[model samples]
Target: MPRKRACDSCHEKKISCDGGSPRCDWCNHRNLDCTYHRASASSRKRPQPAEFSLQDEIEQRLERLESLLQGLRRTDRGDPSPPAEISDKLPSKSQPPSHGGIFYGSLYFAGCHLGDISSRNGIPIFSDEGRRWVQDRTGEAAALEGGQELSDIDLDFAQNKLSDLALLGGHNSAPPLPTKATAQRCLDIFRASTLQVVFPVVDLSTFQEIIDRAYEETTESTRAMVCVLSFVSFLSLLEPQKTAELLPDVEMYATKAQQLLLLTMAEPTIEGLQAALLLCLYLDFSGQLQAASMLHSLASRSLFMLGGHLKPKPPSGATPDDARLRHLRTLFWLCYFCDKHISLRTGQPHAIADDQCDLALCDDYTGLDFIDLKMDGPSLAQYLPKPLQPSDLGLTIIKSKVFSLLFTPSALKKSDTEILHTVRMLDEELERWRMSVPPSVRPSLSSVSDPADPSLQHEFGMLLIFVRFEYLYLLSAIHRACGRCQAWSVDGGVPNAVRSSLLLSVEASRSTLIYLKVASEMVHRESFWLVIFYPLWASVTLFCNIIYKPSARHAQSDVELVSAVPSLLKKLRARVPTPSEALHLQRLEAFIAELIHLANKAIYKHRPENPTAQDKE
Candidate 1:
């Protein structure tokens, strides 16, 4: 899909967009990056109709201003810029309505329905109704199935007290409250409750039904239904071509939604929360970070992260702040996810898969097969957890079960069965955790630590990372067994010593970087600088050989860097080989470069004969 703003190349040029993808036409032919960003001022200018050009928009505005100037020249003529005339002609929208108030630029005003709640009936209206509705209907809605119980909690005023917030670096923006440390850190929350409302859309035919409903809803029930439906409706509206058309309305409603959520923050339920969550999701898709600040605030809490594992008790005598805790946890996970996205974008602070990586590794052939990985049977078994059927169970309490997989899983069967086994066990363990906890308790759970605990989102993250390594290892081992310098498989490939050399390099770079990062953490900062320099130097060697040479070839530079490609292939032949049902050697990421340089340096430079030389000290 075409991205927001412009192509990467256009962004670097610091110019406006004709809004093309792949690369703007100008940059495409020139062979440049194409990741354009939106300028804040661009929004103030009205979106020109499809046929109208940006240049035309500016000219139109200018012409109007020029006409006003001429009228002023007549001295007695009326004021220009018909805002005053429009204001007069417009009916008084000046209803003395008491707005819920604005926090973070959102305008919070509840109109019409509150039903009996607005009149203050005994039936726990307002927050209660919304929460109940969300709990009651979420699962039946397409894309929102797997809904759990309503988890409204009494506000934890003592814990959420201003003093408490300050100690924890409370929401700075809120007092004005607070934050983005990772994954698309900026939240672009908005309310799509109106413009794009529709019934749940698992398919296409119903999609239009939703849009029609949003435009036609006259009552609260239908409006509520429309709100839920619009959550999906907006996804369609977000297509690249249609995005510009809806951007203004989406922005406005997003602002409105944020205001509504913030103003009604006390005991908010699934409807408002989901609205906020969907808005954040939409903003993320559209790359709208600035206006989505409310997401950062709500998601920062602990509830959203841990609530999936929690279950709520009856309405009367439960913990008051549990729901809020759940809300925060969800935000935390989403933010953390985006954090990784940002980190990858920068391509800095790289981490090679460590020993903790998921099973599926067979170090013998990391390069030629799975990538750069080493799989061991016992290691693959570690992550396996007993499968638990889906339900609300405390993922934190299942520590022992988590440990079960840590010990070699006899049940492990696949060649790289350990990862699969671990996941099976985790299924139950995760379910157990999900079933026991209530949403309100998520924040408290965040403080708890258990390797098996569902609260430790890292457990899952680490699992995925491990899986990547396992595959890398498997791929490399196959390459080594078959023959180096071939694709994954070639009917009669034979192991080439030179090809193995390159494979070894990929491994060495990563292993050493990990060792270095760990080692540096252990030493005095000043002394550690020396250790850090080696990894950098090693990385430079690889870069000079691979990345720099490749770039030079593309740039037609004097360095003649492309010359190194042959050596790289030769080195690859000596390092590892592909061996199996046929063979092949897919490409590798830059981290592999570091591995090769470090491996070759440690092996060939200091002790050329020690082909299997390892850093044992």
Candidate 2:
């Protein structure tokens, strides 16, 4: 090594070394990732170039050639590398950058440069014009007195500039591109030599590193975005113990976000908070649910100046930045937790604000615009009351009931017999619901512009959303269940199907797992019924043997009786009638009481030894 460097990112990229500090010169220089601390507790070993031995060079060259050849072969063969690979030599880099002694490649791009090297390695070379554009940016940075360490003010200025640029780019057509013929004329040199290339702007290590650095440097206003994204990127992994270790940083960020909310632009702060939320969701996706949920809870309770909840603070000097907008959209994204928001949640729907919807803070957020809000966060609509017209209330009831049935008696589509029964019951329930809408009061079936417009037929439209979720579940289950090696026959086990090329990828356990995941829906049918159902389903697992045999545990009559409560409640609550119509809740409650008693008595009389069985859990 010529000399030791401060930041790993700088060293790793073989960029010009600057004074070793918390941030490196290159990172400070380029506003690129500059998070690496100089390795501590170890001294930089000085390199005294041992005389270049031919064998060493040969060995290195051979190794590089082998790697490149393998990659090329793989590409041609259409066999992608395993995602688990920690580091594969990028196919786009013709040669490694020279620290002191790597030949890498001597490419011709007027002369060899990073871009040239990239092109040599099969990475797409930006057009010469692109290079010119990049150089212009670098030149502008250079003129800024090599500003490496940015203050919050500097960051704001830079962010504004970038937003302006992005807006400009989005709106203006690239100052008319030179004709392809003319554009091609400038660089006829490497037209045939297809060697230079560069890797993707984001790779696993770099992406992770950006997050790591951002976390280290963030203010409260910026913390949430990083927190949410970190989690989102890491979730649903096979085993995520290592990934979850990243949570402490997120917590730190969350604290900062809270402060930002109280002290600065509430909207920007909220955006970062939203990002933090996404990180929580990713944690869930990766199977670290407890931790994800805990984070969510913290966010909801914390002072992140949540617009939906907070009484507006008096207007301050903080102006909104485009980054804030990006962050808001991002929060909307993170709120998507598998089917819900990953953001820190209060374990409740966002409370609809009591007075005027806070317009100064909020950019008109329609409930419909956030249809997926349920996935990433609470439905903003639910937090606020919808226009409580009779039609609106009726629609809400109808949709809720539809879901109760779809979720009930277990979402077991494997049995066509059960599915048909469920559908028939659903049809009858709908007819009942329709009947409740008396002929005199029912809206006319006139020329409707589009069935997709939920705002018009709000109740019926919302019901469609529930229907879609069920449909998605069904399709995904069917797809997963199609694994020939794991196909379900009448026996409820995998049966062989004619193997197809894609059959190897079918995930049999996926459908079963989905059913298992939403299993509580089968019992209590609340949105969170799955949380309760998990324990019950797990009871059928070997781990449950610590207490009782799975077969015996699941077979208990009490379990069946309890599971029925959700559906019964769903049936009762889903069809909320107007106060005028008088939903005799007392009668419904009494019926439930009778059912529970019968179920309990049946359970009390149940004998495990009896061969006859009627329990349908």
Candidate 3:
């Protein structure tokens, strides 16, 4: 006779099965119900087998009844009631097979039918019903034969049920909210340590007012603000080894804050939107990109619905009031900044485009100067950077506009000449922006001499470093766009024009590397919130140039710039203690290591270790 076939599960998985009776080894190993189809003479075109022995016949009948009971218990629990009365369908042990021992075959057929019915009704074989079904069937099976099989069935049922029950309970429940005094402490920590650097959109006094008001009423918006405050406190705890002890409380507050955020997502308001953006920043810092993307999109939609992108209309007859406009304008620019930053990282189109937005630029806020107002009276000089200065806001808009101009669908169709022209216009405008930088904010060449030392010579704050850094990045972006399109020229290899464009890119990348070298050493460093991408990608571009244009005039400088990146990143990584920062640094370090190996093999093989030649052309 032909051997028995594998079980359905094994066949589906395309694996070999031992083809054991009642249960195959493959499914058994995985705690899955091993089922085998009884071969029929007609289907296989084979001769019928001789009659089974009396003992074999009795075992087969018991197995069939057990399978039937298992099927009944597999029905969907949501079916309003438990499985039908299966015990009534089983035959008694005292009764022997009637009709020449055909009873075993009949039981097997009934089991197959019940299993198919239960599966079609959307029931899982391993659910609660299956557990109860096994219990009932095992008792009945035990009466017929008490031995190894009965004990095995009972053991498997107990083990599986315990595992299932463990999954149903929330064993790792969250900690309770911080006490009022604890919350005040967390808030104080945030205000004293983080608010200035983080540039929280919520004003200090306004935030304190919200915290006080939050205790009075449990509004969704207020709760969201509380969560935001908690996250700010959490960020503050990320640095300084001494603060490590307080991290657990920070984590608890952060979790509670997220739970409250989810509750307020249904009915979003300006306060809620602000809170959501802050949460997005926190998530981005934590390397939770998927969650951050969702909140970023949410904040974008809420801002648009509130007409944040449009210029505010003045009262019909009243004096043109622009006091509150300053705050609203600040909110709008922050949203735009976030949209552009996320868009570049994700390669997704931004929600708000240059054409659709009519809001005033950050540069326009200079005359009004309402943003300079401090929490304690009019101490404008202290808040000079004013969370985000007019210049910084202008630079952010410039980056946003550049991204729009480069990534739009139609950009690919433009000719190389058109792209070059666009680059020229942007470069000229960028030059003007550089000239307009306040004398106090610009760093002297001497400031960057000792790459390891932080810059203390300048009175300017983080805003200056941010603007300078972004300017270099934008120049790199423009040239990168120009160089990418020059590939379609259909000319000789590495044409001078293409080489020149690529050279501009190398120079821009060099500046970016130098800025990062010094800026990474600043007292209040730029947040690693997507700001890290500029140096990371700029290094990649420089590496590609060293390999592809080894003969270019600036080849030595390019290699030097690329070689310095790993050390620069290490210094920067030492400043931030977050896991996300560490992960990014590890990957970047690996990338630079590979690039160095490749550079040694390709360019350094023929060149001297210390070449005196400089790129004069």
- The residue pairs found clashing in candidate 3 are none
Of candidate 2, the 10-residue stretch with the lowest lDDT total is 192-201
Q: What's model 1's TM-score?
A: 0.24
Q: How accurate is candidate 3 locally (lDDT)?
A: 0.49
Give me the runs in candidate 3 sitting further than 4 Å from their true place.
Answer: 1-175, 185-198, 217-247, 314-326, 362-364, 367-386, 389-391, 442-460, 486-488, 492-498, 523-526, 551-557, 574-583, 605-617
lDDT of 3 by residue, 93-137 (tens): 123322121111011111111110010111111222222222222
In model 1, where do residues sit more than 4 Å from their true spots?
1-237, 240-248, 289-297, 300-306, 309-617
User: In model 2, which regions exceed 4 Å deviation?
Assistant: 1-271, 282-291, 301-327, 333-617
Clashes of each: 132, 48, 0
Q: Each candidate's TM vs. the true structure?
A: 0.24, 0.24, 0.61
lDDT of each: 0.28, 0.29, 0.49
> For residues 291-383, could you state the per-residue lDDT of candidate 2 as single tens digits?
455555554433234442333343354545443333333232223222122111111222121132322223432222323322333233233
